[model samples]
Every structure is written in structure tokens, then in C-alpha cells.
Target: MQKTRPILAWETLLDIARTDAPAPLRERVEHALRRAIDDGHLVPGSALPPSRTLAENLGVSRWVITEAYGQLVAEGVLDARAGSVTRVAAPTLSERMPPPHPPSDHPAPTATPVDARFDLRPGLPDLRATPRARWGSAVKAALSSIADRDLAAAHPGGYAPARQAVSDYLGRSRHVATTADRVVITHGASDGMSILARELRRQGHRAILVEDPSWPRLRDIAQTHGLRTIPIPVDDDGIDVEALAAASVRTGARVALLTPAHQFPVGAALSPARREQVIAWAHAVDGLIIEDDYDAEFRYDRRPIAALQRLAPDRVALIGSLSKSVSPALGLGWMVLPHGLNPEHSPAMPSLIDQAALAHFLVRGDLERHLRAARSRFRRRRAALLDALRAELPDASISGIAAGMHLLLELPAGADAAELARRGRDHGLALTPLRRYEDVSRRPEALVLGYGNLDDTLVSAATAALATLLRARSETPVASVRSERTLTG
Candidate 1:
């Protein structure tokens, strides 16, 4: 006796097919059907509509439907016995394997705590403020204006118009001296640093000088490329050029990495004297300086210091990115290469479409207008966080607030910053201890509080929670605190 077949719901399949896909029409149909089956919208023993019927429904050629069905059948995702209606096949042997479990001693990794109330992790912008409508308009303008030939292949350095836009923006804003010809677009500052590190290694440089308590990632990048990193202490006047020079002499290291505009983790502008000293040191050693202009766009105290590259363009390689001023997710950055120092290998570039869109955005003056509004918003958020912190913990030393999204908070002596950070996680407040960025022996008993992502409304509550924890720590008996530290350390 023949049995009735279960009819598949064509609406689900039709919706999936109509959605945008990056592949050919036939491949899109195949992927859509597979997704429907995997998602349980189409179960095993369900019969698909005939190719002619589905093609008519989808407004595609019958050949497309047939090809999709044929491919799925070949892959064992669909069953099409000569005269039988096509149906989802049983789970393949490869798909039947059980999920692997972690070792009993090691637990599976977890994401950000579900209970997190405030995120204070630094190096993030206010994602809520992204200019979606303006960006969409820029993208549309870019698509309409771009030549067809420009899309066929991208220049390794960057899309020409995008590079020009960046060059002009830098000149006007940061006072960086460079032309589009010398600009190399990159995925972001990290990618630009990696490229420079590799090129430095290739150029027979064995050692590189880095700030002692700098962003750990920069040192890691140099070390990864086989360059020994000599730690140079950074004081209130930015990187210690005298110490850096001494280190260079001792180690024969000729390359240095600096965040001259506003130092990371610790905000200190390179003083006029130190700037001269650094440039002189570079000239004396015939060395190179890699300047990371990470957050030079949002200075509140006064006009931002001019790019160090502008002082001696031939001696410095300046790297800047949109991560701080704009959203990091854009993954767009530029490197103003020193004259006669182009890398043999080009660093990875961002999407050509993104490059075109940015060019349009810049040319239309949308970026400048957006930044004016962002500065006002971030300024208010920063002030709120600072006011809350001051009210909660008057004795705690807070600095590095002159610019950038984060500030350095130095707790009173004997406070365990690491322990506070750990406890913060439990209390639904995410915190980062200064120790995370420094060497193990260097303990500043400080925390880097990022106010960028923290909502203005949560400032008072989050600060109060942090103060309560600190007060609790202060109340513990000295002996008990030492014992706890000994056990944890």
C-alpha cells in the first residue's frame, strides 16, 4: 500500500530564498534549503514541492531549483529516489557524532558574565551612538559614484580616494605631514603595528624599545616577530627618552614604540623637551619611532598635541585608527609611512566598499559633524563618571581624564586591586586592574576605569558599588587580609 507523504512548508523555504545571499542563485537556493532542514523547519520524510512549482513560486528559472535539489541530493542532505518526491534525509554519520566534552579538571570557557551591570573595560567607544543613517547614506553615495573598474581589484596600499581622504583629514586634524602616496591603509592600528614589526625584523633590527607599562599587545606584537623588547619607563612627560636612549645604547635596539599624543593606560603628553630629546635620540641612533596616535581625537583640556610625526616626519611612522573616535568594529586605520620606508609586504587592507564609503563620508564632512556631536556626548559621560567617583571615593587618585575614554584610578595603599577586580565580577560590575597591563613585580594598586561604554545613567550606582567593595576591604583585619593575599597569590 502506498503511504501519504508529509508536505514541506514552502513559505519558510520561500522566505529564505528571497533573503540576500553572497552566492549564485542556484547556490543560494541550495544553502537556504539546507538551512531550513538544519533548523528543523523541514524535517525528515517531508516532501519538497516539484522543481516547476518551487521555481514559479520563487520567481526563478526551473533550472535553478533543479540544480539546487540535485546538489543537495548529491550531498546526502536530500533524498531523491528516481520516482520519489525529494525529502530531507536522515542525519549523516558525520552529523551524528556526540559533542566533545572538556577534561574533568578544566571547565568550558564562558562569555561575559550574564549578571554584568556595568562594563568598564577600556578601548571601546559608545557603540550606541553609531551614525547608522548617515553611514548608510554614505555607502549608497559611494556605490553610486564608484567606477566599475575600481571594484575589480584593490590597491595593496589602499583605495586611492580613501587614502587621499585620510591624508587630508590627518593634515587638518592631527597636523601629520604626509601625502596620499605615503599613506598605507590598514585593517586597524594593530594590523599596522604588526606590519611595521615584521618589516623591522626583516630590516635586521633585533631589539625594539617599548613603554614599560604600555599596552601589552604592542609588546606582544614585537616579541612575536622575533624582536627583543626593552622596557622604557614612562613618567608624567610621556616615555622617558633618556632611559630609552640608555636602553638603546645597552641593547643596540634602534626602534621604539610610543603613544606620544596621549599615552595609553596612563595619560601623559610627550613634553616639548622630551619630544625634542626623542627626535634627537632617533637621529643620533638612526633609529625609527612608531607613534600610536590611538585616542588623539577627543582631548577636552585644550587643543590636542600635534602628531609627533609632524615634528620629524622622516624619523616617525605614525599609526592612527577610527577605533577610538569612531567605532572599532569598522576596522579602519591608516599608517603615514616615513619617506623611503615603505614595507616590502603590504599590510591587509579593509573592505574596498568600506574604504569607498569612508571617502564619501569624509568628503561630505559627515565625519567632522559626527565628531562634534560625539565630543559633546562623551564629554558629558566622562564628567558624570568622574563626579560619581569623586563623591564615592574622595581619597582615590584619579588621573588620565584630560582626554580619551578611560581614566587611571589609584586606590589607597594596601588595597588589593586584583582582588577588587575579581569581586567586581561577582557584584555585576566589570573592572580591570592595572596589573593586567604591567609586569608582575610592578604593583600600582590601581584600576583602569573605562567610561566610554558605561551609560551615563549607571555612573552613580556603579561607583557606589565599587566604593562599597573598597570600604569592605579596608574593614578587614590586617592579618586576615595578608593571609588571604598569601593564599591567593
Candidate 2:
């Protein structure tokens, strides 16, 4: 059964959010973390997020979150004053042991440090800046409007109002037309992929064709469910379609996932013509295309491009979420399947089964309204973040500044991205390393700095620190005299 993949937004605190989130958000995320800890989802005494890194990951300026972490420290929930490391306090929840999270059969929970800065970690967006009041109002409205009976068990596909909102949001915002009935709301894009993986596997689907430097997690999720992933290299125009076709034929992998618009870290947009060719390939091979729209909302240079889902809704599974546009902590994202998909089944349609828990949640949920509010707030915050990036990184020569919460800097070769991140963290600053996303062993040196969560002041500080770091590096022996051979080539 295919579960509609909803997206997950992981932020530590919303309690002290000066602007982005509210107490409930903070409480919920923190509560989840606490439960995960006590329940073993997060190991006991696992390295907790350095408040500063938590701030960066959530799109909040670091100081506010730093203070919040101090509170947790004071409350004995976390260890404070642990420079550069945020360690979870020993579990104090023994009073009434909470229910254990069912052990995941997939024992692989990727061990990601909550405090990783200069993250450049793929599949995430700066989400600490979404407008709280707006979302609160939406949630209130959705809840008030719900019928007592509506809260009873319903379709696992998703709730109608939220599904309609998503369908509308995609159609209007992304130029992809679809009815709410076709939308499946899972926990996040990850959940959607799992469902897709499961369904395809059940029907004998064996392999997935993917971009070589594509999101590692997608392949992880795919392989977790027994699908062989084929690597297809990407160039400036997005995935090498010809290469993908060749790989598909060579490997007999019929399903392929793509980030055509703002293709992951390199920020390549698939040309319109190439998108058409991809559609043709899918149709010709009876294959499926998973269009992962990782970051389409914050293009700075020009208008946002329409989604590939628009060109061929029947063949493309459009994956979108508010993580980048707003806050990942909200855990709101959606999957739009082609009208060809099932249980709306037909030969032309691909039938998908829904998960039971997801079905139960929607029957009694207010998620749809929250998504609407989140999208609206995120759009506004994205603009603000962009302005901050431009003002702060004046000397860095930022490109792909067109959209998204983050931008890239073309740094000198051999620049140590991890070192730069470390130095930033040492001084109350946080950032993502370009090496985290690219083929570090081979890709050019760069940095993926985020502007979404921080206010102008912090953004400026981060940039200023970055400038100093780069300057110091330039003055160093290694940078001042690059091997003549390194430059000649």
C-alpha cells in the first residue's frame, strides 16, 4: 500500500520564537523529542542540538534558541555551557514511563547530529521563520469547523479540506492541476516515498533510477524497502535524461525520482524541453517519475518556475512541503499522484493503498488549514530571508540567490567547508557545509549558507563572521600561494 508522503520538519524549540512559531509548536516538537528520547527513538544521552545549531536548523536566529536551550539546561532537561556540543540531559521521565515507540523494523535511523551547521544537509529547509499567528488562526478555524462525527475514522488518503487546499495550492502556485481526491497526505515526503516504495515493490517493481549526487536519503528509503536504486548523473540541465534512459534500460529500473526545479544542492532547473523528454521516457517505458520539489518557493532572481507536475500530472508524482517555504517543524507536506493512480483504479490509473493510521488522523484532523496558513506565512518569510542574504553576504558572490532559504558561494578550491562551519559555531554562528551535499571527494569547494530563519541582524553577523573566516584563510600560507598546477588546470 502506498502511503501519501507528508513531510517532516525537525526543529527543537518554538517556545521562545520571537516571530516564527508559537508555544504549541515548540511544545509539540520538544515533546516529540522528549518522547523519542524516553521511547528510545533518540538514544539516552544522545548528543542534543547545540541551541545555536537548533536555531539554524529551524530558521530562528540563534540567540533566542540559545536562551531557550539555557532554560532546558536550567530545567535539567539538557546540558548547557557545553561549548560546541549539545548533549541531551539524562532521561528524567522515569516517574511514569511512557509507551515505547514501536520498534522500527528498519533499524536504520540515520544518526544526524541535531547541531550540524553549515548543514548543506539535503532534504531540509530553514523553517524557523513561519508566521505563527496566521497558522494558529487557521488551526483554530479548522478545528472549530470540524463536525464531531468528522473526527471518526476516514480515508487514509487525507482529509478533504486540506487535500483540497493542497490541490489548490499546487495548481495555483505550481501550475499543476489536480483534484483533492488525488492528494495523499502522509507524514512528509519520506512517508510518501515509503508508500510508493511499498506499493511498487508489492507489484514486483525492483529498481529505482536516481541522480548520482541526488538525495542520499531517498535511495536509503528506497533500498530500505528492497528497491534497487540506479544512479543517473545530472548536469546543468537537470538529470541526464539520455543517461537515465540508458541506466533504466541497463538496470530495468522503471521508476525515477527528480528534483527538476532547483535540483537539490547544485540548484539546476530542468529545462522545459528536457522535462518534456522525461515525460516521454516515462510514458514510453510505463515507468513512474517522482518529482521531488525540494526547494521551489524561494527563487530570488526571477519568478518561481512552474512544477514538472504541470506538464504531465498523470505520470509525475509531485512531492511538495512547507519545510522550505515555511517551517519543517510543522510536519506538513503532500504528495499528488496522477489521476492514473488507484484505488481510483483503472488500467490507465495506478492504484495506491493508504495507510491505516494516516486515514484515522485525517478523519479527525485540522492539518489542512494549518498547511494553508503555513504556506502563506512561509512565502512572506522567504522574501525577508532573501533580502537578508543579499545584504549580509555582499562579498561572497552568492548565486542561485534567486530562491530558497539558502544560497551558495563559489569559494576557492581546497577551502575546508567543515572547518569554516566549526569556526562559525565557535563564535555563536551556524552554517551548512557545501561538502555535505556535493560529492565532497570530487565536487568543487563551496558553502550552502541559509538566510531563512535568521533576522537581518544575525544574518549580517553570520555573513560578517564568514567574511572574516574567508579573509583569514586568504592570509594563510596555503591559500595565498595555490599550487600553480591547481590554478592552471
Candidate 3:
């Protein structure tokens, strides 16, 4: 059966109306009506009053009523039948926001062990070799000492002691300038980025500049704040600062997001000259820089490079996490903000209850012990990868291997790294394409191989698998004949 109700003409007209109602009353009613409609408080086909009579009922003028109602008709929210008789229009389904994509139900599952398969998933620390036994002891110790009220609810920022520890650690390791007061505990780097993005938006800066071939999760976090995202290109030295300056000037980019320590997946450390140029450019442009120090603790070659934050703390926001050092299970992350750009919530940024109860257990005691073990394990895995890669594919060169758990193998010219990645999976191996990081149309040939979770035996197998790929590509006369080159030694 069809149903009908009264008109919204008068109601909507009052909204956009140049009403004679007091300005305050006009705004209050307008907001209330809009919110009611949005929240489903005012359903479709709801009634409105007669113009002259309702104006009198509300102690208002007919002119006010006419103007308000006229607006509703103009907006198509009301349908006029005869003179002065109007009805509410049927609601449109498009008025509501679309539902979100479903959450990935699980981690992209890794297949069971296959002979000689090298696993190169990015950003994973070798947990199997982490000193789990020691971590267990720390967990037990932390649990035994915890007070009853500690578990009820935490300080919205984070545990104070953990903040103190992180402050101390960052000072020593990342070259960040801060005290415990400057530290805010967070779920991880992702959480801190979200909070910073929102706070930046509040400060009247909305867009973020990210590396085209950078971490994907950052795109999601920046977008959450209704901020626009811009992609900056990267070359051997790091983000093309000149190009970034051009983008900023052209687009009025207010902030630049950087993973300058060692770029994600690509593993190229930002050169000293480029780092200084970036800092200077940001200052000259009055732009804020976000420095993500993802894997600074595990560089196997040379004394560690100084973090970009240390060079310019006033303009730089530093983010680091325990997932790559201690355990992802903890989900613990921290940040160092320039004294005054401080976050109101410690690490609570965009998430409520970001981690499970067990996270605190990893923080209070096991952290120091786990970091020591993780550093050692990644060092071995990094070295083993380089050694095996050289022996197996002596001709298949690698980059970004001087530091971090992953390295990039620039494929022979004209080969599609993205397709090769899929091919690796087909052969019961897991690998990633360098193209995933590229933001623009690129035809480069490279693959990012992570060795964090792979064992020495599997490392050998994976290297052999990759070597076969290189050999087969070389055999094809149509494939562009280019020498296998190591971009990062």
C-alpha cells in the first residue's frame, strides 16, 4: 500500500530562509533540522505546518514562512501541488554514506614450507629467533607486580613508565631530542600517524605528501582526517627534494611525510646531502616533516646513520614502533613531538583501546631484553641474505641491503616486477613487487625480498629460486640485456 504525509516546505525554507527569525534561533533550528534528517530523526514524508497559521503559532511573520518554504521547494526537498500546498519529497538512498569494505579476516596466509622457498614479506622482524624464553620471564615479572587498578583502565595517553623507557631509548638510538615529557605512548606507528594527521588538520593543515612507493597504511591514516594525499617521487639518494619543493609550491602542500631513515621496502638510506636539503627546504617553506624511523635499530653495516629528527627536531615529528624490534604482538609504538606540537592524548590518537591487555606485559619488562635479541637476529638474517644472494645469483644484484631486514633486487631491464611477484607466489613462494611502492607510472624492474622470518635453509632456497628467475630471464633474447647491478652495497 502507498502512504503519504505532510510537507517539509515550511521546515526546509526556514533552514535556508533569509528569515526574520532571530539569527540565533535561525541557526539553532537549522542545525537541529539538518541533524535530525541526517540521524534519521526526521523520517521521509514528515509533515510541516500551514504558512500563515504556523507563522502565527510560532509567533513569526508570513514572510519568514514564505522564504523558508520557498527554499525547501528550490532544494527539491519539497513538492508543490497547488498554490501554497506543498509535500515532503521521498528520501533518496544516496543520502547515506556507503558502508566500508570488509576487514581482511586474516593475515594474508603464507603457505606451508616448500623446499628452498625464501620468504621476503616486508616490515616483519624475526620473532622465531627472538628470545621468547626471556620475554616470557619479563611478562611473568610484569604481571606479578601489577596492581589491581592498573588493569581496570589505563591513562588515556599510555603507561607512563613505558613512555619514560621509550624516551630514553629514542634518545640513545634514534638521535631524537626529547625527555619523557615529550613522549606519547601509542599502539604503533600507524596510530601515532593518525593522531598527528587529525591534529594537523585541526591546525588548518590538511594535505600530506607521501612517497609514491611508500607504505600503504599511511595512505589510509592520512585519508581518515579528510586530508588530501600527494605522492612524491624517490630516486637513489631519497625523495627528490627539488621535485618535492616543486609539488609543495604548486599544490601548497602543508606537510611532508618521510621514512628517511631507510625507505620502506626500497631500503635506500637518504643521503647526507639530501637530508640537509630536505630539512632546509621544509624550513624555508615553513612545512612540517614527519620522520618515520622504522628499522633504525638493526642496520648491519657501518655505525648507524644519524636520524633526520636530530638534524631538525623543531620541524620534524619522529615515529617509531616495537613491532620491528621487540614484537608485533605488543602493538606498542611511540613518538617524539617538538615540545609544543604535543598531542593531548599520549598514544591514544585515533584508536580506542588500541592494544590488548597483554601489550603492557611486553612493555614493562621484556622490551629491553627483546630488543637486544631482535638486533642480533636481524643482523644474522641480513648477512645471510647478502651472502646467499651473491653465491646463488652472483649475477642478480641487490639494493637496500646495507641496512633493514629487506633488500631490493633490480630485475633485468623491461621485466615486470609486479608480475614476477605473482609468479613467485605461484611457485609456492612469497615475494613483493617494487612497483607497489611506485606512485607514478614506472617501468623499472625490481623486487623487494624480506628475510626477517626466513630461516638460513629457506634463505638458500629462496635465493636459488630467485637465481633461477634471473637465469631464465637472461636466456630470453627478447629480454633487454642489462647487467645485474647492486644499487645499495
Candidate 4:
């Protein structure tokens, strides 16, 4: 038994039609009435007011109302009885329309929160120190100097001046043995690695040696290019070069990817002996090395180590980016390739505006100035973090603090790193479990804590919170139980 819908009165119809008119009054009225019937706004078998009365109520002429009603009648949209009463006709399409979908009881899950208040995310540079004014000036200068030909279609490789600027910068900073022609600009270090992997695959190489417990994304890039990754273990003195050689020989891997200068989260500069041995292995196997010179500029303890590419120019491709030194948002990186090795695979180049701006930035020595100031600032932050960590976790053996923005803290044997990370999150802190970097079970349980971006107050607070959680959960040796009560209270 269906309940009857009330008749749509003339005033109600006029009220519905009073929405902003699309254009002329005639077209507006006609379309509005027809739409109302079609959409069941004026329901089937409902009475419509007489034209004269409807027009009078709507403030439109009677002819307008009559014309609209006559049009609907001709279209079989309305039924006009002999008594001169117009009623809405039964809807043909509306009757066949699908029912509205019911709303779901469960909504989509929200994205994971990235902005942890005490975020200690490793590998993130101090973005707050980016020289914005200098960058803007460089961009302006670059725009003013950009030639008409630069706006025309250029090679997908990259702008020559930008590439040259990068080449000169690398030669001066990393001591990479290369020229402007050999430098290929990329969006960033990751993109540069991907491009190199693709080229290696093109050359029929299937396997490449990677440092175990290295940046996971580096292995991902190689694997994504269809290359099998052979994990070479990394020790306190950087990658074990002998193990690397043995693994490469066994796996028939002709390419090795390494971070020789300030080895990632571990912060080990490859021992001179191991660096020489790895280069020898590359020569022995006719292999090539890809040196990721990421974060070489932020060395705190002593003079920065020279790049491995400097020693083996013909057998190494050095990749570096401004992301770590300047800011990650500046997506600019370069690869200084070995001579005679043509990376013919063209990558989609970055914006000409960005390229030109970076070129000007490099040439103007703004990068050096910023790095000088940033190094001092980072050094202070690094010292603060170390002091706090020492004060909090006396028994913990923290390594990799000699260089880079992060340090690896080795927890007590049998302690749960993953669980500690979970507890850290409970206190609004973010921790990177060391196990995440290794695909194998060689490395011990540890946490890679980055003090790069956080200020002194943030560093102290975050470390203190982490220390409290660790003390509550584990019996790991801490500096003193006295600070624990202070932190918790």
C-alpha cells in the first residue's frame, strides 16, 4: 500500500522554479517545469495549477505559463483532461531509475600521520636553514640571463650550463674526476640511481652488489629496473670490500652501489684499505661502482673524506644531490659519469627554470656560503643530541655520530627494537628501526636516530621522551636512573 503524495501546488511549483534563472525567462520557465516533472519533483498524477493563476502567482505573463504547459503536453510529459485541469504524467525514465546507494557504515581510513611532534626521521636535512632569499635572487638572475634559444626545444639530457655548473661544483667539493660533458643532471639522487640501474640493465647486467643495511630505497631502485641485488655486508669501517668481491664473483654482478663518503645511517667512511680493495675488485671483475656521495658535506668530526670516484674515474659513476646539503624540496642532483661510458638512455629532464636557477645558484657560491653556516648549525644540533643521548642512555653504544645527520644506537642484546619504536610512537615520537634497512638477518637490533632537523629543545625533549619509554620497557644501561625520574615526572 503506497502513501499518496500531496498535489504540487502552483505556489510550490513557482517557489521551486524561483531558483536563479539560466538565461531568458521563457526558456528558464519551460526547462524548470519539464525538469521538475522528469525528476519527480512534480510527482506523477499530481495536479498543476491553471496557467492564468500560475502566471499571476509567478509574476510571469499567462502566455509564458501556457507555452510551458503546452510544450510539456506536446512532449507527452503532462496529461490535460477535458475539464482543463493539467496533471503531471507518469514518469517513464524516472520509474526505471536505479535506487540510491546506501551509505557505508565504515569510512575510508585516514592517511598515516607524518608530522610526529618529536619526529626523528633519518636522512631529512635541516630544511629550516634553506637560503630562500639567495635562491630567489639566483632564480631572478637566471631568468634574466636565459637566452631565447633556451626556451626552444632542448635535449632531454638537461641544460648545458646547469650541467657544467654541477660539474664544477662536484670537482671542487667531492674532487670527482669529470668534465661538464660527462655530468648528467637529474631530479634528485633517487632518480639518478634509477637512471643508472636502467642503463646497467640495458647493458645486459642482471646482478648488482649493494651494501647490506643500506638505504632500502636504493635496493628498490635497482630491483625495479629488473636487476637482482646481491647484498654485501657493511661493518664499522663501511662495506666489507672482500665480502663484496666474493659475492660479486659468485653472483656474477658487474656493478656495485655504495655510499663511501659518510656511509648512510652507519656513518662509516670506508677505510682506505677497503676503498682501495673495492676499487681493485671493480677493476678485477671489469665492474663499475656507483658512489652515492649523499651528505658528504655535513661531516662534523674532521675533514670530509674524498669520493671513491676520485680514485677510479673510469670505473665509478659518482651521484650527488643538493637535497641533503641544501633542502630536499630542491629536487636537483647530478651524476658525474665515467669517460667513454655513454648513458644513452634519456630521462625526462627537470624544469628549465629550476635548472637555470640551480646553475646560477652554484656559480654564485651561495651553496658554499649556506653550507658553511649550515655545517656550524648542524654541528651544534649534533652535539646537543649526543649530549642528551649520553646523559639519557649511558649504557647504549651509539655509533655513526662521527658524520652524517643520523646516528645508529645499538640496543642491549635481546631487546625488541620494533616494540621500542611502537612505544616511542605512543609518546608522539617517530623512530626508524634499524632492521628495516636490512633484507637479511646480519645486523643487530638498533635505532637510527636523526638529529638533523630538530632544534636543541626538540632534540632534548624527544630524546628524553624516548629514554623514559626505554627505561620503562627495558633494562638497557642508561646514564643514570636520576634523569629517568626527571623525564617521566
Largest TM-score belongs to which candidate?
Answer: 1
lDDT of 4: 0.80
Per-residue CA lDDT of candidate 2, range 1-489, in tens? 112321222342333344344465445445545555566545434566655667677766666566555666677766545333555665556734765764666755533344544333334544454456555655555666666775664645765666766776677667887888888776567767777887778878899988756667777899998998877776667788999888888888889989887766655678777889999999999988998888676554455788888887888898776556555665666788986565321121111121222222234333345444544544565455445544643334444434455556656655787777666666555656666654322455666655545443444455556667766766642243222110000
Better of 1 and 3 by lDDT: 1
- Candidate lDDT values, in order: 0.82, 0.62, 0.69, 0.80
- Candidate 3's residue-wise lDDT over 10-115, tens digit each? 4443333345555744344444445555665555665666767656765767776666667666776655566534555566677554546436766556442334
Off by over 4 Å in 4: 1-112, 475-489
| Worst 10 contiguous positions by lDDT, candidate 3 | 350-359
Number of clashes in every candidate structure? Answer: 0, 30, 10, 1
Please give the lDDT score at residue 368 for candidate 1.
87
Candidate 4's residue-wise lDDT over 1-489, tens digit each?
113653755655544345564566666777778777666678777778888888887788998888888888888878786755688876678666865753666764533236778878788887777899999999999889989887886755688899899888888887878888888889888988888898899899998898888898888999999999998888778898888878877889989999988777666778888889989998998999999997888777776767899999999998888888888888988888897677764547878888999999999999999998988888888778878887878667777736678888776666678888877777887888888888774676788888777766788888889888877875645432222110000
lDDT of residue 41 for candidate 3: 53
Residue range with the least summed lDDT across 10 consecutive positions in model 2: 480-489
Pairs in clash, predicted candidate 3 = 13-68, 13-69, 14-68, 116-461, 118-462, 120-450, 157-346, 185-347, 213-437, 213-438
**Which TM-score value belongs to model 2?**
0.64
lDDT of 1: 0.82
TM-score of each: 0.79, 0.64, 0.69, 0.76
Task: Write the candidate numbers in order of decreasing TM-score.
Answer: 1, 4, 3, 2
Candidate number with the higher lDDT (1 or 2) = 1
Clashes of 3: 10
Show where candidate 1 strays beyond 4 Å. Answer: 1-104, 109-115, 345-347, 440-443, 476-489
